[model samples]
Target: MRARTAAERVACPVCGTASVRVHSRYVRRLADSAFRGCPALIDLRVRRFRCAQQDCAQATFAEQVDGLTFRHGRRGAGMQAVLDRVAVMAAGRAGSHLGQVLAAKVSRSTLLRLIRRLKGPERVTPRVLGVDEFAPRKGHIGAETGFCTGQRNR
Candidate 1:
């Protein structure tokens, strides 16, 4: 329900300064996985640390918990994982209905959005290539090779 940053200091993003000076604290409400068919929630209290480097443009920065959540993200890792799988398994409207049936309660547009966020398969050029040969007439004597592209000796 409630949580706080355990780290004494956090590194500044701009100049990489490990700042120990405390600036402020903020509560980030994250939508987590469901508990007993109910949507779970987490109120994470994070701290903002002052930048130690004088030349650093950032005055303060927030501490992040590894594998817990990311900046500006409202959903937790567990919740995101479920939604991602649902989106992949079914298309937008179908997945949305499935989400509601499972008590995940995601909108069709949200499911579509989540699916769109995933990166497509990487395209690569093959180093070696092969082609299949079809049989035009199997019993033909002279036309044995079928139709293949190669050097012909007449």
Candidate 2:
């Protein structure tokens, strides 16, 4: 599908200044989620705007459509989310197979890379602690082990 952004003005990522001046235009090809068991592609025509701020580090910036596009992203946000979920659930070879079944058709290496890119779940300290004394080696008098446990503040 071919489409163009309808935004009249967009904010510069660096300076946050809304710019209406068009520097250039380019087509971004994005891989979208499967539609009716067929792969979907979006040829989006987006504009590059010249930053209005004089001191802004960015001279020009590309306008991104919210929820549809992101910086340096080749896949739509929705499609990327689906792939991320697959990567987390199956990983590597399994994920690649799952992607094909879902009509996404991504490589195993890509799935692994997606897994690496995912942020780990937040760590929570255990509410209860358990400790026990034990012997390291049976029939060895000097081989003994010990453990320590303590409460943690939230």
Candidate 3:
């Protein structure tokens, strides 16, 4: 499918100044989620707006649609979310197969990259700690004992 952005004015990312000047326009080919068991593609025409601020670091910035597009993204947000879920659940090879079955068509390496990009879950301190010592041999006088520790979250 083909579509174009209709935003009249967009704010500059660096200076926060709204700009209505259009520097150029380009088409971004995005892979969208499956539609009725078929792969979907969106050719979105986005405008590049020139920053109005004189001291802004960014001279031109492309418009991004909320819940649909992101910076340097080739897939739609919905498809990205689906792939993220698959990456978390199945991991590399399995996640790639799952993505193909879902009509997303991603590679195992891509899934692994996605997994690597994800932030790890926050660590929580355990509430209870237990320690125990066990001897290697019951009757041996020179046997060494090993200590083991365990923790409980709640």
Candidate 4:
């Protein structure tokens, strides 16, 4: 679909002005469900605009489509969520495999990057986190493990 000036005039939250003018233009890569049991991509043309109000603090703001994130964000929110779940379970390898099958245009590293971005930072207290070796594997020798906290903070 062709992008128009009026269609792009989404209300600017900072100024509450609907009189936005196009400052620049770009293409956004988004994910969509393919008809043949695979995934597909939808390239959305995004526009960056200047808010029409004189007192507005924002010099220029990129247009935001509903149900989307960054203008050219590689994957849509729903597809990103699926990739995230797969990533957490299988880490990079599984996520990359899935992306390939779904035609999501994501690499192993890209999947990892998405996973990292989505997970963000987790707060952890106490000195250490441990894993039991015996209960999970009784016959295994010296399988116990512990991670020293604060390694990341430093």
Candidate 5:
């Protein structure tokens, strides 16, 4: 079912100006959390407001339902949160399997990509690094490019 917001105005993100002038309206399709083992959809009536701030860089901004969804995001915040937890809990394949059971239903590659996009460990200076040495390729390892290795036949 489609739903409309009770709000009449929204603040601009860049300039913090309250705008009530409606530039346009559209139905934003969002994927909500599964219900009783069935998927759900949210057809939200989103309104675009024209920014009145003269210095504001953004001309138009769409209304966002806080804690419910984000701009251009396909899934609801709750489902996205669950996916994030799953991505952190296990590796790609494992996380994907867990998500399927949890009703998130994300793919392995997507899970892995999400995990990779998250912030990494904090910065720290390395004291020491261990390594296993191996022969360099091409036998030109120590030889200059001007001269060939060993001896050349006349």
Candidate 6:
């Protein structure tokens, strides 16, 4: 386990006060990328502190790295790193299965949710939009496709 935060001082995001004291620390396990067939776990010991500001909006918040967020999840950030790779190199059930094999403990639906989380919201105002769902192969009863018939947005 590595120290999540050192003695380096951090000011409150909402305030400029840098007077804070370390109160305690805890470990958070996150999934990281995989090597071959094995998954990696990142054990981060997060620190807790008390803000000395009398009018601060927030009393405390765990420090976050550039690509990480607190309370976003309990799984390791490494898991999302791996999920990102799988999402890019694979799609649909295959990616889901790969995530499961890596001990993500996620099902196909969960995997899709993870993918959607990574993708975030779509903001494109395209001239045309197409939505469809299809069977993995063919000759399946659940095969479906969707197409937009609306005019192009300006």
**Candidate 3 residue-wise lDDT, 1-154, digit = tens:** 9999998999997889999999999999999999998999999999999999988999999999999999999999999999999999998888888988999999999988999999999998877754422333343233233342232222
Per-model TM-score versus the true fold: 0.72, 0.80, 0.79, 0.60, 0.73, 0.58
Q: What is the TM-score (0 to 1) of candidate 1?
A: 0.72
lDDT ranking, high to low: 2, 3, 1, 5, 4, 6
lDDT to native, each model: 0.80, 0.88, 0.87, 0.64, 0.78, 0.62
Clash pairs, model 6 backbone: 30-75, 30-76, 31-76, 31-78, 31-79, 32-78, 32-79
In model 5, the runs with Cα more than 4 Å from the true position are 121-154
Error of 3 at 139 (Å): 23
Clashing pairs in 1: none
The TM-score that candidate 6 achieves is: 0.58
Model 2 error, position 95 (Å): 0.7
Off by over 4 Å in 1: 125-154
Q: Per-residue CA lDDT of candidate 5, range 54-111, in tens?
A: 7789999998889887877888888877787788998588998887777777899988
lDDT (tens digit, per residue) of candidate 6 on 1-154: 3436564776666676774577667887766556676665677777666676978987876655555535657655566666667776665688878767876655566656666777556797777643423233333332233233233323
**Candidate 2 overall Cα lDDT vs. reference?**
0.88
C-alpha lDDT of residue 99 in model 4:
65
Better of 4 and 5 by TM-score: 5
**What value of lDDT does candidate 3 attain over all alpha carbons?**
0.87
Give the number of the best model, judged by TM-score.
2
RMSD of each: 6.1, 7.0, 6.9, 9.0, 8.0, 10.1
lDDT of 5 at 137: 30
Tens digits of lDDT, candidate 4, 13-92: 68878855788888776675454766666677777878888889976787776665544566666677677776777667
- Candidate 5's displacement at residue 104, Å, is 1.8
**Model 1 poorest ten-residue lDDT run:** 132-141
Model 4 poorest 10 in a row by lDDT:
145-154
